[model samples]
Target: MFRFLRGLVLPEAACDEANNSSRYENLFKKLDVNEDGRVDIAELHAGLKALGIPLGKDAEETIFKTGDSNKDGQLDFEEFMQYLKDHEKKMKLAFKSLDKNNDGKIEASEIVQSLKILGINISEQQAEKILKSIDADGTMSVDWNEWRDHFLFNPATDIEEIIRYWKHSTVLDIGDSLTIPDEFTEEEKKSGQWWRQLLSGGVAGAVSRTGTAPLDRLKVMMQVHSSKSNKMNISSGLKQMVKEGGVRSLWRGNGVNVIKIAPETAIKFWAYEQYKKIFANEDGKIGTVERFVSGSLAGATAQTSIYPMEVLKTRLAVGKTGQYSGMFDCAKKIFKREGLKAFYKGYVPNILGIIPYAGIDLAVYEALKTAWLDHYASDSANPGVFVLLGCGTVSSTCGQLASYPLALIRTRMQAQALLEGAPQLNMVGLFQRIIANEGILGLYRGIGPNFMKVLPAVSISYVVYEKMKQNLGLA
Candidate 1:
């Protein structure tokens, strides 16, 4: 019985080896330009280029010398295999570097120091955050098993594979303790499942906005009335809103707000895909600059398409008692009273704010991700979820800081018509008026509530998005 089993297993193992040999032979053929059964420097360079891996002359020469195991000027099949084996050895060396003191575990301090060597400055707090992610035993360090498991699927190469892995999207690193869906297969993508994804995103948005509706309403109130005679503090604002409009009034404009999410998410994602295609190189890779440009343009496109809903949402939120019944009533009244342009009340500032917000957010997030990978992620390309959330929160906050004044201007303009005896001001006129009347601080009137909602809102949104993705079988 043992002999029979061995015979069966031996044939299967031989077949597997044959398949690997066939794959390597094909690669060798592709690299052998002159069909000489070996790869010279020129042929190797061309082969690497064809594989979307560009190397400088010095790097190429170094690789060629190392791969020429027989001391020949060219790389035969045996030498090429040696080069692949060297990659595995390099990965082991990288792990050893992280395993300082030869303890077979990497502590947070070691990670922090390693990142410093890579020119990535990180705080001890940030290092702890990263360790908390992959330290499965709550020991604040990564054992060999955990480290190997975390990076089992990642290519055993250097930063090149890291860059390629993150080239698509940074969704994985957007929230604390949230697990995004894995990368989609081409078959799943081409199967007309976009609507499902959009539906999931829209549902997540609605839930997040509704959960944070009170803060959002308070923000609008502060934006429109905090500088007025009302002098609305958070408590007074809540009391005033509740006394006048009842507790349910806190969600006044939430209908239109939720309604706009579907199209906005769908359009932004679709436009991003199109822009990526436009910006991709011949090898279908997009650099960081191209990714930022595509994201900014996509955001602008979505915001433009959904500007009317934004106007309606603000109007309904800041409207007086019984000013308009609902979304349609508000829309009709605005169209009749202020003309078609009313729907685009704050269009300019809104569009202008997109540039800084998207730019800063993308830049900070990418820098943080790259730094984490360089320092904390010894052999792994995946930074822990906590690291992503920390990076995302900081980046989003910075983006908000850079663009808050524009946001305040946009909000004020959206609610302008609702304010009694308020003069209509153009974008520049409004900035001047706010500066003159309330000082530059007027632009940050509701910023407290605005910031108050960021963490919970983002956390809830990401959690729901992941859950919905799973339910839809898209995860």
Candidate 2:
């Protein structure tokens, strides 16, 4: 991007350079913090953050590498001035792109149009709110100087990248989960921060799943076997499991369950990006419908690829000891007896459940985020760790509540579909049978165990992710 920006000589840059010298000097003084002749990484990072245009940890290093010609690890006045001028040139180009008519000013409509081109949809009011932040004179529009000053400290050369950062870092209280694909900046992708974030999240998820394996297995067991006559309460369920197998049986299916998370996340995120490009409108617009379809399709894509593992999970979770020695043995026997189709036993209901789960999860999370920003913006844009965990737990619970019946049906199919001479059921038929035979309450048979796991799972995942992010230099 900068290479393209470099090819164009700013026609007025040299002519107006002298007149802007003092402006550059004052800006340099402000960035230097201690009034020193040189600016360090700390000062630059702080300045950008304070201005609410933070470019993350990699930006400071990139700036020094490009502008710090002396290689002394600091940006002196000359280096600073040079960097700002080049940066301003790029910012000017971005401004012109948003200006649309080459009118030397940006209106809210243009802001909306530019964002749409970047595949982000926002109302005109949202665009106006954005403009107000940079519209220094309150004319409800932004001119060259306002745009330049607003982005002076930001290292992003493109307007889209800037918005990406703003969206993720501010009002960004999210737990580590595959409920939504994580968004990354171009810098994060290029500088390797994206993988660090993913790795952290993956590690967090593995630990969380492992930590909650017992409850997860119990949930599966309750979903499959718990009925009115032999009502499986928690204590009795625990006793029954330990009595049937050893204490270790509580974590029966967790290994395959945890192992599938990484590949599942990778596939989902990759599918989401591709779907965004394909589903974007002629004008590159992405509205809520696009987001919902993309997210649901991505979830389905991930579920499809890892569905064999999912079947294994449900089977192992509910399997009695010695029924199948392990995952591979189980898979081997199923392949031998039931053929390859057994691996995707519950795929129909599983796919159908993705829509409600994704929709409710995203809607709840977004509503919570907007509520947080409205009530707490003056206090801080970022929510605390506990609040984030709570929100994730609530949002996930809501999603699960809306789709738990399908989940129960999916589990039942995955576990019971292998029975000899049993009638197969599609998602619709499974829904009807479960409601008719087991009653509506049967749909939520395992909801207690499921709810019990959310808090601990989210807490463990969030804490591990935060620690990993810090270790990876993302904090």
In order, how many clashes per candidate? Answer: 0, 0
- lDDT of candidate 2 at residue 74, scale 0 to 100: 92
Q: Residue-wise lDDT of candidate 2 within 155-219, one digit each (tens)?
A: 78787766754464311112223365776766678788788888888888888888888888888
Best by lDDT: 2
TM-score of 2: 0.82
For 240-332, candidate 1 gives per-residue lDDT tens digits of 999989998999998988888767776777778888789988866666567667777887888889899999989988987788899999999
Looking at model 1, report the run of 10 residues with the lowest lDDT sum.
173-182
Over 4 Å off in model 1, which ranges?
Answer: 1-185, 191-195, 282-284
User: Which regions in candidate 2 have their CA more than 4 angstroms from the true location?
Assistant: 1-16, 26-56, 69-72, 99-119, 123-143, 169-180, 280-288, 371-392, 417-429
Error of 2 at 331 (Å): 1.5
Cα RMSD (Å) between model 2 and the true structure?
A: 5.8
Q: How many residue pairs clash in model 1?
A: 0
